[model samples]
Target chain A: MNLQARRTGFAVAGIAIICTAYSARLVDLHVVKHEEYARLAAEKHSFRQPIQAKRGMILDRNGEILATNLPVRTIVADASHIQNPDELASLVAARLELEKEAVLEKISTGKKYIVLKRMVPDEVAVALQNELQARKLRGIYLENDSIRTYPNGAMLGHILGYLNHERNGVQGVECTMNKELAGVDGHRFIERDRTGKEIMLYRGAEAPAEHGKNVRLTIDMGLQSILESEVDAAFDKLKPETMNAVMVDPSTGEILAMVSRPAFDPNRPGDFQPSQMKNRAIIDMVEPGSTFKIVVAAGALNEGTVTPQSSIFCENGRFSYGGRTLKDHHGYGHMDVHEILVKSSNIGSAKMALMMGGEKFHEYVRRFGFGERLGIELPGEIRGLVHPPNRWDKLTITRMPMGHSIAVTPLQITMGMSVIANGGRLMAPTVVKTIEEPDGTVFRANPPRVIRDVVPKETASFIGNALVGVTQPGGTATQARVNGFEVAGKTGTAQKVSEKGGYAPGKYVVSFVGYMPAENPRFTLLVMIDDAKVDSSVNYGGIQAAPIFSRVAERAARHLDLIPTAPSVPLQTAPVVSATTPNRRL
Target chain B: MNLSFLTIRSANRIRLRPILITVAVLSVILCTALGFVSIKLSQHAVAEEIRKTERAVTRLRSENEVLLAAVTRLSSRQHLTSLVAQSKIAANYITADRVARLTPPASDEGDSATRTALNTVPSRSATR
Candidate 1:
């Protein structure tokens, strides 16, 4: 059996030798060919993406594009891959109107990918592509990208704001609501060539970008245009240090227009100071002048301390009260309540305040929402100085009544006037109307947040009628009278306080606050000409501010389409001759 | 013992069975390796198919961009206004509003950059 054992050993060795060779081949595939196997495995997990979603738009109330993302093209070139570099450069230079040398310089390199152009229009990109393809040129490429575009230009610039070069919102609503305005970026999952070109891999997988939400502002574009144009004129003609205008729906407090002069184009917001970039309607605070008189008048009428027919006795041209001389525009012998506003009698106004008493007068100013923020949804606001009754100075009680010893912002004064105009309910001013989601979801700010009923509707109406006399034939602001509408207005000439110390010597704050269709007001406009033209003859708020108020009021009243109530009222007084109230040697 | 033919034949047959079994095992090990190689080659071909499709998609995209640009240029307001004057399609000089995408109409928000249909396109916006 030794012969049989030897044969068995030989057969077993032969089988072992064959199995070793086969196992070596398998090891070569798993280890020696590891790179190839890994590559093959990766092929299962590749993807490509196309057509990134467009960023959402900013539309006006009527679907006009206040802001939009226009489709732009980025031209790129694979310099190494190019077949005829000169031909591609020539086409790009010709179509893009670029310097031939510049185009040549870009394609001269051996780099596979080079930026030929950026922010190109889709049309230009397609043209370049077509030109290249027709010639079978290989290197040139085009990528579709988007750039933020503002269609209205500088119409509502600061309020609308703009995106920077990196597509970042930097100011205005665009900055404040940037999270909603900017879209989430997404990428194509395609296999890239060594030079970063998307390879000829199969369409594998994709995660599309989530587009941003569209924002529609409360501003009416037409009204915005009107306010912009008017404000521009005021700055040019009047040439004030600064001018601001805000028009809001008194009933709802929805801001129809909020315009500040010295506006910069949002397309290049970086070129200006932060002050020029602010929406002054919400941010800036100025001495309210005589406009604050509405709050005091409305309160006194509401408290039953004064009636529509309540009269005041003026102490000739100047009356000494509270260790101060209360002056009048002229030496009025005896003026009635309505005539007091017509004459802008400081003495009569102080006397009326005295009748209301210091405590009640202070309560009226606070209740009218003065001496505090108007509660508008914006970044910066100022709480104007009213010296809460407990902090009144020796002369504060009397002087505050004549529109002094107090400071107020344009926004605060506007809200206070709105209370009287909107039948005694003080509405909170609002700039933003609504916010929308990408999935067509909408959230609105539509709350009628009343601060307080500072005055009765009847009293407010009575005060409004008295205001009309100020724009009558022989009134303080006669120039503010509209041809069709009986204007209710007040003229104010207050000495501007210096920034360093006390009141400036020569500079004056000449202004007028008025509402059109006097009997039933629809719009309240406040026009102030700070440090206005003060010549020897014509130096009063009636001359400088009243005319601007009238121009703006006439245009606004006609545009608003409000019919005049008393168009044929009989003329009871002479034509306005003098607004000379500053003759008092202070 | 004399030469016994039955015992010798039994021993040879046992040795022959082991030798045949060894050959059969060797043949299967080599054949299975060859089969694995063939399947791997097929997988490589399927992967190449994806690569080829991606190249085709790239070419198509480039072509789409070319066509879109051609359409924009051919219908551009500047091109059409030049066409109208040079071609003399209309009898008299055209108003700016008659041009394509160049001017806004008499009414509505007729800005220069507003979107325009063929009807809204001004045939002549050139002040020349």
Candidate 2:
């Protein structure tokens, strides 16, 4: 071949080799490395974001909001994007109520993510965002957040518990009904461009969050405030170590108002101790004192062991049984059942218990819902101690009848009286009224639950009439009387149990449990003052607790608008004993 | 004769090339303009709708928050009690004497005032 022909052939061969190599590289990129490249692209643009659900609100029976959420923003920073760390830090510090130096230190680190402040309210966050935009600043980002707020502060702290950092209920009804209150959270797949702006066109795969359900409690804030005010006054005036009160509607077993002193605010529970956070109405166990006498009286009436007119001979204020001397406040002769209760004759009650055997008395005690948990909706209830018949010593029968050698919660004592006030039925106490949906639909409603009938109507009325005498002129709790209403109640003065296992000297747990307008009872209220700082002689329930009961009952009657069933008489005050004088029982 | 016809056909084909190229250029220009306008119009419509939705959401949220704040302030027991303490609100308690009986008397035996007080019935609305 000639020289020109050979050169042409070489050029064609070089072109063919280049074409083959390009085809091979295209095949590898399109087939072998496709998945890895696709994943990297997605990571650069798209992210999975969690849509947070709003927690439920807690409301009172009157539709007053108790616990609610305040919308807030969590300010986050991208340190790497910050151009002027000092300026950003100062602006954030002023707007978010944070330390400037700390914010500066955090932003100076070339990290991508830093949290500047959490729970900045909506207004503050809006102001900060506007300032950043106008000044052409960068690095700060706002994410949605919320804070749990109790509008009434410490008013219902024990019942409507507070939440923790993760928005989980930590105590009280909040913890018990957490699942119903906390709604389901949703998720979404979203894409953002290089400018960190959401690309609406590329948004995909979203599920909207279901907001939490609202909880409406049976608590009436009006009644609650009344109870709290009275209890506060008592706590201040009597100077008790700890005081608690519970008020329940006997007809329905609905807890209207319950309060305990030294309460911690649920909004800021971190500052309080566990002891102060306890719902003492259901948790604290105390010897019911003379309030337990109603149980024996009801049992004797229901069991046909005693008639309302039957007279029992008293031991003249002192009776020796099982090496222990049982004594009444005063000497008495033969008195009927009503007279025995009016004067709180301890020997008479012990005799009635003796008439009914220990086993029968224990049965009556159980039937009144004592020595067992009342099963209220609030968490951490305790079944108080009631010794079984087999466990009772010879002295147990007498002591138990007089509210000794037994333990019961304040809720139990109030409910035991309810059996008498409601005309012969035991009711299961309830705090929750209804569960509501976000759209104001009631998801579930609680109705009155009747546990069982403990006695006949006639029997309850007979005992109720006797309890009415308790607040009369010659009775023990005369201070419990309201001007236009017939108050039926019992006064208990229990010697405080010592830490070493015997009765404490000069210390008493005094209480008055009662109902007003005795013909048609409205509420059964229990006011318990533990360890009042007074002379033991004047530290009786009739003196300290009954007066408070009267004050609260008077206000409650007006609030409830219950018509006067009895004629209005001249208001009379209980005989005042000077604080300096040695105390004496009625 | 065949050679002459071949020369004439070749000359006609060369003359028609510029006309065909002009038509093709015009078509390309028209198509590009129409597509650009359509896409711009669509993007503007979508952005406007998005802005409208955002404003609605913001307004509803603001109203809801305002109502909630008002309810919270008014219904709060602490606030109302404070009002009562300051005498800004009336917590009136009607005495038995103020209440007049609507029903006929049950008995005329006791003191007339006492009988009237016992017969008066409270309105249920007042209680709630």
Candidate 3:
């Protein structure tokens, strides 16, 4: 073989080895290491950032803004990028009202990122940024944030609810309508320059945020104010353990105003006890006393077992049934159904129930919306305790008719009276009127919904007339009458149930449930006071709760613009000033 | 014989180098001038558009924030109550007897217009 031929063979062998190595490297780069390299490249240049959607506003029926958001910023520091840690720390401490030493320690750590302050107002944030830019500072940054604000302070706290740190609703209407209020957040992937400014030309895969829809409630701010003022006054004066008042339009089941004492401000809910946060108007249960009489009277009349003029012997106000004796506040002879309600004769009511039987009477109780949730647009509503006839003891029938043995929420009692006020139809209560989009387009509307017709119009009218007698000169709740109007109402003075089981000693829960203009019912209102501080002898519902209802109804009637159906009766000289209804023995 | 001799002399002697050089220099100057003017015009147009858009965004944002702040202040129950208490506004309620209406002929009991008005009519403060 020649020397030139040997050299050419060696060169060809070397070239073949080099080509094989190159092909292997190409496969590794394109397949095995591709994902890792691509991820690293993306991390170096592009960033995924969230575009936050604005939380919705809450408004009243008249479009008054109840809850809103104020734009703010969160201040952050990149310790590694800070040129002069001391100067930056001092600047932040002065501007943000932070501890100087803490700020210094945070900025000196040489970390990639650190949160310096949160929820800085937009104006302050802008001012601080301007000063920093003027001084040619780096490392410090501001990110968009927001804070929830309730401008009404504590007025509608329970109804409006509050938001958590993550802007999620935690209670009340906010919790019930959270999904609609939270809206859909969007995102974008974009390349940022070295200065942390987004390069718009390199923006990738962007989506715009969908803002939360607005919620319009059925609450009337004016009526709410009136109710709050009157209830607050009563709460302050009576110093009750708990106070609850609810006002509803009988014609439509719209809740005009609702208030419960021991309320916490939603803006500062953290400062209140868990007990104070309970919306007791719909959550707490109590025996409704004589207010439950209307159900039996209406039931008997509707069932054709009795009429408005039907007579029943009262057994001289003391009756025995199921081995237990039932008594009334007064000993009476025979009384008509109208007289039974006016005198709040417990024995009369019980005898009437006995005539109607337990099963039929229980059906009426359920039909009047007791023992079940009213399905208001609120959270944590409870179906109150109502024992079915099968679960009832031998004495349950007689006792249940006079509002013992049965537990009911204040809202239920109000709605029960509304059954007569609205002419025998039971309505589903609603708090929210409409759900609106950001552009004022209505997404959903809540119109009046009739649950069922509990009785005929004639029966309701007869009951309404009897209820009016309850607030007349000789009736149980004469104090509940508003000047120049025929007020129809019932007074309830129930012995509270003891936490240790039986009836509590010397503790009473008193209430007044009523509607005005006996001919044309407008609003049905309920005021309940539990464990009032006054003497037990003066703590009857007609004495304690009726006057409060009267004041509230007067203000409410004036606010509602209801025309006087009856000639103006002379205003009584402060009905609460006198103890009209003695705490009679039962 | 003399014409041929003259033509050869002219061809060998004088060249037009100065005229060609002048034309080339003039063409280069004109092209440079045109390019500078075109670049400056584009820059001005882009800068103006950026300014206009920035101004528009700023104005809209300012208006939105102002309206928001105003509404927040006005609708506040606390503020309104304070105003009423201080007699800055008259919101005292009118009783049913104080109101006298020109009753419409043959109105029914269910007529909404005959119902009590919930809103207050402004009354002068006694102290004021």
Every model's TM-score on chain B: 0.47, 0.45, 0.42
- Estimate the TM-score for candidate 1: 0.69
Question: On residues A32-108, what C-alpha lDDT tens digit does candidate 1 reach at each position?
Answer: 99889866776655534555655666666555567765567888887777767677778889988888889898888
Q: Interface RMSD, candidate 3?
A: 3.9
DockQ of each: 0.04, 0.25, 0.19
Clashing pairs in 3: A559-B118, A560-B116, A560-B118, A561-B115, A561-B116, A561-B117, A562-B116, A563-B116
Which of the numbered candidates is closest to the native, going by highest TM-score? 3
Per-model TM-score on C-alpha atoms:
0.69, 0.84, 0.85
In model 3, what is the error at residue A494, expressed in angstroms?
0.6
Residues A1-586, candidate 3, lDDT per residue (tens digit)? 6888989988998998899899899889888999998778877888887888888889999998888877778999987678878888888899999998999998888886799999887778778988988988888988777777888887877788888877889888888899999899988887765665555556678898898999999899888888888877767666777888998988889998899887888888888887887888888989998899999999999998887778889989778877878887889999999999999999889888989998999999999999999899898888899999999998988889889999999999999999999999999998999999998999999999999999999999999999999988889888888887999989999999999999999889999999887788888899999887777888899988898899988887787787767776775565443323343210
Regions of model 3 farther than 4 Å from truth: A1-40, A575-586, B1-70, B86-91, B105-128
Tens-digit lDDT track for model 2 on A475-535? 9998898978999999999999988989889889999999977999999999999888777
lDDT winner between 1 and 2, please give it.
2
DockQ of predicted model 3: 0.19
TM match of model 3 to true structure: 0.85
Using lDDT, rank the candidates from best to worst: 2, 3, 1
Candidate number with the higher DockQ (2 or 3): 2
